[model samples]
Target: MTLRTSAVQESWGPTAVWSCAHAQGEHVKFFVLGSVGVSHGGPVLTGGPPQQQATLAVLVLRAGHVVPLHELTAAVWGESAPGSAVMILRTYVWRLRKLLEGGEPGKTGAQILESANDGYRLAVPRGSVDAVRAEELAAKATRAHAAGELEVCAEALAEAGSLWRGEPLAGVPGPFAESQRSRLAELRLHLLEERLGVDLLRGRHERAVPELTALIREEPLRERPYGLLMRALFAAGRQGDALAVFGRAREVLADELGLDPGPDLRLLHARILSGDPALLPAAASPAPGRGGGLPAPLPAAPSGSAPTSPAAHGAATAGGPARGGAPAGLDGFPAASAG
Candidate 1:
């Protein structure tokens, strides 16, 4: 059966919903983001053996592409495949097709799970897979953030963050799943950092404080989150608390990594100590003209007045090389540098 689209007339206009082009399409849905499983348009399908599920996990991780038989066997069996591994692999594929397509063996079309020249391919629509959709949203968030559209950036990031139900590939065991679990988790953390950066730029310091605090507690050794927490505290008029946070972060880094806090952190500490007027939140400056160099650094705020937040003042300037021979790493990532 082929996948079919149906047009329905509505009061506003005509709308379309995809119907089972295949007789059984209405009953089948496949998923692999949080776990490897199938749903017949309702509850998750079960009763398939673990090995079959592992095979399916590998396929889903590499969805919309070809996964060779040998690679599949290694992922499922690791280093201990039996002589009948190929036949057994074929069996698992057949079982998955049965679950995913609701069709008999050898009858499922190339539209869903197809036997390619050298491997198997699962053909599904873009964004049908949750992980792919999350990545797409993250890309959108990155673009919005770059354009200084903080509201759009936050909304896209929130939607992307919502896609994770739990540990990705949870309960699905294999080399492929194991590796991908860590990779996806790291990507999620990066997205979170990006979101926090946008929040700081948008003057959401009070809102960012709790989230950055929790992130620092969870990952004390990571430098970026601590930087964010410090910035948030300072922006919220908690200068003492911000300095204390730097002290604690310094302790964590020195204790764990046997290294001092980086230049960015040191510069931020100096600014907080002298109460630099650049730490207050303000509207971002307009983008530089085409081929024009970065905007000049914001002038220091008047004494006793709210200073522009370091993120806002430096965000545009940070895109260019550090002025006056500052470290290269301090340019892009937010951290107060010498003024």
Candidate 2:
């Protein structure tokens, strides 16, 4: 049997799994989206043993690349690995192949895990792993925020948040899995913050408080969630609660980082103390006019059209052309002003 179709190219889901597996054997591929499914002929065999799943997790996380046998064994067994680690790994691989091929209990499975001189390769194309898809959704959500597509941004963030079945590489123990877990967790936090930021901007503060409170509980050291909590409290007409939240944040920062809160937090504290009406979106700015104090006008573009040096330009106009027309490189970021 063979699986072939363009549906595999669309947004990943059960349908995409079916399409990818149903194509021809020529298009056969392994996909580990929300669940494991073999795509040789429309998602035939699904599921795998714990050890086999762990082995595939390491490879899929590595994503179509050779993972050294030693490294793979270490990830699964840590320092007390068995003497027959290679044999055991081979057995796991054999089982995974059988699961993928949909063969009878005793029949041979498809050839998915390819052996290399020192390791094994997953050998699937890009976008086959659900984790990869989750990361892609996160990146797209970030871009949507940058582009000011707030509603779409929230949906994308939610989609990214939904990718995890549990702790990544769960049951797998090693430095690699630990690092991946930490990185993915941090990204999840950032996406959550982005979603909350959009909701706060839209004056949906009341709806954000519960979520923000839970987030702050999980990440006490992160000031962004505290800031959102404060905003939500202030908007909800609980000024005292908002002030208490600020105090808590200040104490946590001092205890954890031995430093004071950043500019945003300091500004918020002053606003609360002085009763800055602008703190509440429904109120108008306290200043004479609606416009906040505008910074100095940006310098004129470098004349002579030779491409201004990004480094030569002042911090305010980092996006503008270089001041001295030097070769622009990554180091061309404008200097930031001190508060």
Candidate 3:
């Protein structure tokens, strides 16, 4: 996966992941978007043992940066590390160095992994790591969206989404792996919302419905998805269903969080109640005024989820995934306004 250098700079700024230059040649491709492993130049498609893989995962996540000895030990064995932990870590690094450098290195004899401050840095070429590449794509997508290039934005986010194979750091045990997994899951959600926003802007409301539905089911308390789903459903000629969506959102918010919908959501409810033509798909009608920008929220599926497809992005679930329940209604919603 190729990434734009500008995007890398945009995302990381002064503290980028590793390299800004897109270097080439015999570096092995590292993957942590799914399983923790490496490929290209090695006989073993995956890397070494569980602990070794965990060690490498720590390095891969911090690729281009030094990983201190203490952090490495915690990533591999947590606080219960044995006295021989240092020796084991060095041994793993030695084996990983060989594994990463096993392929041919004729003209471009790039260093795979290096040691600094007695710390480790996996110095593979830029864009060689799927996780890093995905972030670059996301950054690019953000730029494209800012430029009003809806199709380009959607494509870049979709490409980023496709890099995921499964649960991040799959089968790799340790605190680092577990934490990174959750972090990446959050990124996936942001990517999904980005794509959905583009789709909605491009007048793909019908297309956004299923995802919005799944998102609402997964995150009943979040108002953004509910708003998006309501818009999509309203534009699809299901105003009744759209109203029902607000009903569900109200129930869930009241029950789960013991709160009423915020100003944005209540105002949206008012607009829908007042028959805002701006809610129509953009392709069918022009939005004549301001104060109509939408928001995002998602949930309901068991994720380690992948992006919807090449055109769309992904869905991610979070804590206390909603069950089939809602609370009593609260009053004082915003009043409908005449535009």
TM-score between model 3 and native: 0.74
For candidate 2, write residues 24-117 as lDDT tens digits: 2334444443344444444324446555666766776675567889988977677888899899999888777656553222223444566777
Residue-level lDDT of model 3, residues 211-241, one tens digit each, is 9899777656656667777877888888889
- Residue 120 in candidate 1, Cα distance off native in Å: 0.7
Report every candidate's CA lDDT.
0.60, 0.56, 0.62
Give the TM-scores of the predictions, in the order they appear: 0.72, 0.66, 0.74
* lDDT assessment of candidate 2: 0.56
Task: Please write out the lDDT profile of model 1 over residues 1-339, one tens digit for every residue.
Answer: 232433422100122222234333344444554655665444556527777877877766566678889988888787888899899989888877767764222345445788987789876543344556566666676566556566897877776666565666677766656666655655566556667866776778899999988887776766777777787888788999999998998888777768788777788789778776566564332335633334334232112111121111111112111122332211135422211
RMSD of 2: 11.1
Candidate 3, superposed: residue stretches over 4 Å from native? 1-27, 41-44, 107-110, 286-339
- TM-score-based ranking, best first? 3, 1, 2
